[model samples]
Target: MGRKAKHVLLTGGLVSGLGKGSVLAGIGRSLQDRGIVVNVIKIDPYLNEDAGGMSPAEHGEVFVLEGGEEVDQDFGVYERELELILSGKNNITTGKMWKRIREKERRGDYGGRTVQYFPDFVNEIEEWLSSVSQTTMTRKGIQPADVCLIELGGGLSSYEIDIYLEAFGRLRSKYGKENFLHIHLDVLVDVLGQFKTLPIQDSINRLKRKQLTPDLLLYRHKNEINSGAKVKLSETCMVENLFDIPFLENKEQLCGFLSKSGVVECISEQLKLELKSEKGLVAEWKRLHRLAPEPGKVVRIGIVAKYNINHDAYLSLTKAICDCARSLRYSVEITIIDAEQLEEGLEAAIAKLLIADGILVAGGFGVRGVNGKIMACKHAREKRIPYLGICLGMQVVVIEAARNLLGLYDATSTEFDPETANKIILKTENSKENQGGGSMCLGAKKSEILLEDSLAKKIYKNSFVIERHRHRYEMNVEYAEALKEKGVVVTMVDEKTRMPSFVEVRGHPFMVGTQSHPEFTSSIFTPSPIYCEFLKAALENKKCKTSMGLNTTNE
Candidate 1:
């Protein structure tokens, strides 16, 4: 009962790890460049309610939205690619769909009839897309989306995503063929020197079998897709629109590539939209690549992390650092120092830590590298090095400062050592242990700083600031004064819960920790105030070390 927005269905198959999210986001960026309002919807087929409870090793990073929704990492890609703040409502999972159906059943809205997956599921999905069209990104408000890009995860042939495909079929029928564009995204494999078309053919056949054919075939290759291969694919792949998405080291080139390759032109023609190219979106990427690397002027920041297997676990955090630092015209040199390295030898860890002017301890769960992270906090505090700790990082700051400054040797978080005498970080009272990791203090909360001259107040430029949180343990208010007496103060506290969220050391150049993750909302255009201030302090720290004739390089 609303105006129909153009719907584009993006499917994945024929091997994983293709930059489908980036490409889809790139295409969205291209459309937006032409003054089109584009909104992206990511449909995950997993049974989990959200990515919050998923393992970082198995599922990559759980990107937290501004509204505190833990979504797939692709959403992070979409935000950066489109430079728009999206809402959690845009992410749809099978678990979410099933829950909606059950709720409808409970309310007897289905007239007590049996709910089947065909028309019933399709109807629910239709309603979901319709509701999302009127939803805006960033906050809960109305700003009708002109185009909706639905990216489906779980390979094309999987049974988990068959319902979505079925739903798209009905959607195409209801909205007419012109309103929908189904895209099959995959990589064109090169075996030896031969370019194979069989995999691409087989994948499209699966889509046509479900009566849901893809109008566009956006594929990936290493510049191996020759003219003959393109013609061959066009002839056999059923649908005629074939676009080659070559691999690029810098993902920002996605839109620029799409524009050069005529993919953006074709999408606009097919959708019948009259538009003009602002040339603003692609220009930003060009500016970034145009900057030459500053040799000795680079700001080195050592990141003490526990997850070593997959770097995607810290994907957004790294992006925040690089984006904010670039705004200051300083090239970033991020060294992911494994916390386990510190546990084995403090002397070696200190050697590694001294090479960088600033040290950052990222948030993580488990007791594997707890002591190493605690030692890292102590090192940064005493050495006058700029430091920033997030979630678990903030907890370690308190634990380390309590042990060293307050003389509480047994101080530790309740999450790591529940039997410790000094439970500096107490388990949140609202957290439910029996319910399997659902009750977390998630989303954005208002933080109010008491001191007018505090660094946090200066960085935020406001006494009240809103930040996102994703933790279940918080700094205990019972020992707040005792910690303040030792030159550590809780500068920022949640306005709603009155829980201490931001902490700062008295005499350090820059030593601050927050229970919230500031990187989630950090953008190059409008960088996070905390990250901007932290990087500035790190640059100043480097200047001081250089004046002292200290060798900051690892070599």
Candidate 2:
């Protein structure tokens, strides 16, 4: 806290979703690899308190922090790139800031003074950044960040984000420009097979209008950016620090790409930091990637989701599986089986689910696709195929076991069917936790998982562990006695609530479910214990099929 943390601002112009998050994380990783204690922050300029309730179809994925905060999907990229467990405090939002202001106003903490935007809002952002800077998140421990990397959500033209621009400008003035570096990212659109430069010039002008200019310009393109286009942007538009960012297959590849472009060296010099390469993060990343097994050994995974059409809805869920598979040296061919599609009929659902080497039903909402997910769980249970369920998916596993094994046919979740007498999965009686999304969330400090000699223990390698959660319904205890008597046991439990958080079926090939979400915590360097073990089972299933003369894949 003694030294002020250096700030690197990353803002996108022309449009959002240009992979600006990747660039920000790439820069952070490049510095962290060089022995700098860095912290990354993501500021979302939205009205929603948090990203928990946003539609996957619209907002892509809702990334849950270890603290149980549901943030934008970019945080997933940040965690993976930075290789650090960031707190929900790292994710700032307009809704969060305004909510605090309104709360203080209602409590008469503001002293009834009519608050204006300029000093008030800017002061709020600055204070938030100061706290974040003082306590940087790292794998080793919490400490003051040497450099703080912030990814400003939305675009330069976004009206909601104009306040951030003004606040950043004011920050530059207060602290001196030497303490801050601005990276403006833009994409070169391929219009009729020709790369455009005029739009890039316009974005620069827009930045100038906001009284902020880019020190480093990170640009994305469909193909290699033409040299002429680059010259025009640099000479004419006065964009001196231009860096070309290309499409890379792996998320970690971004830092290496920028390193080869000499972008890392340029940044360190501009920031005036001692350029010392420590363990070589880029080198280690590329080394691991080069050793990945070929796609010859494929693991077919079927993900049952209500929003199957939107892959981003389950971005972390899918990424966890993919990352785990890569760690075990296997390729994954994911099939998004719509839960609603599975509801047409049990037979229809089975036919669709037959394509999976391992079946996974991720978290979801409502009664709309509840039956389909149950059918998928049933198929996996009966066929003895490796299966993993999460959140709503976990509830479906419990429901399936009750109906088939315990003979409770009317068993259902209160969330899906309130009228059902046998509610296997229902909302908590007294406590209030969204299971895993929304404005308020349980922090990482509270979540606990107590494991036994089950698969959960094998994967986690600990009798007690911590993970994330995102669900309204939990595993009910009313039917727990009978279910446990039938070899369906709750392996891991919420330490405080004593609620069943993780479930595993005995005598099954590989059946596991957890009320908490493991996908949210899985990282490229260390895969989520649950996901890693789940994929390992699928790999074994693949090997078993190959040994018998059965096709390894349904396709």
Top lDDT prediction, candidate number: 1
RMSD of each: 2.2, 2.6
The sequence of per-residue lDDT tens digits that candidate 1 reaches over residues 353-460 is 778778899998888888888878888887888999988988888999889988999988888889999988898878988554468888878899989878888889
Q: What are the lDDT figures for the candidates, one per model?
A: 0.82, 0.79
lDDT of 1 at 203: 86
Give per-residue CA lDDT, model 2, range 497-549, as digits (tens).
Answer: 78888788889989998877777777667788778777778877777777876
Candidate 2, TM-score vs. the true structure? 0.93
Pick out the ten consecutive residues of candidate 2 with the lowest summed lDDT.
438-447
Clashing pairs in 2: 67-444, 435-470, 435-471, 436-469, 436-470, 436-471
Native-to-model Cα distance after best TM-score fit, residue 107 in candidate 1, in Å: 3.2
Give per-model TM-scores: 0.95, 0.93
The positional error of residue 87 in candidate 2, measured at the CA in angstroms, is 2.0
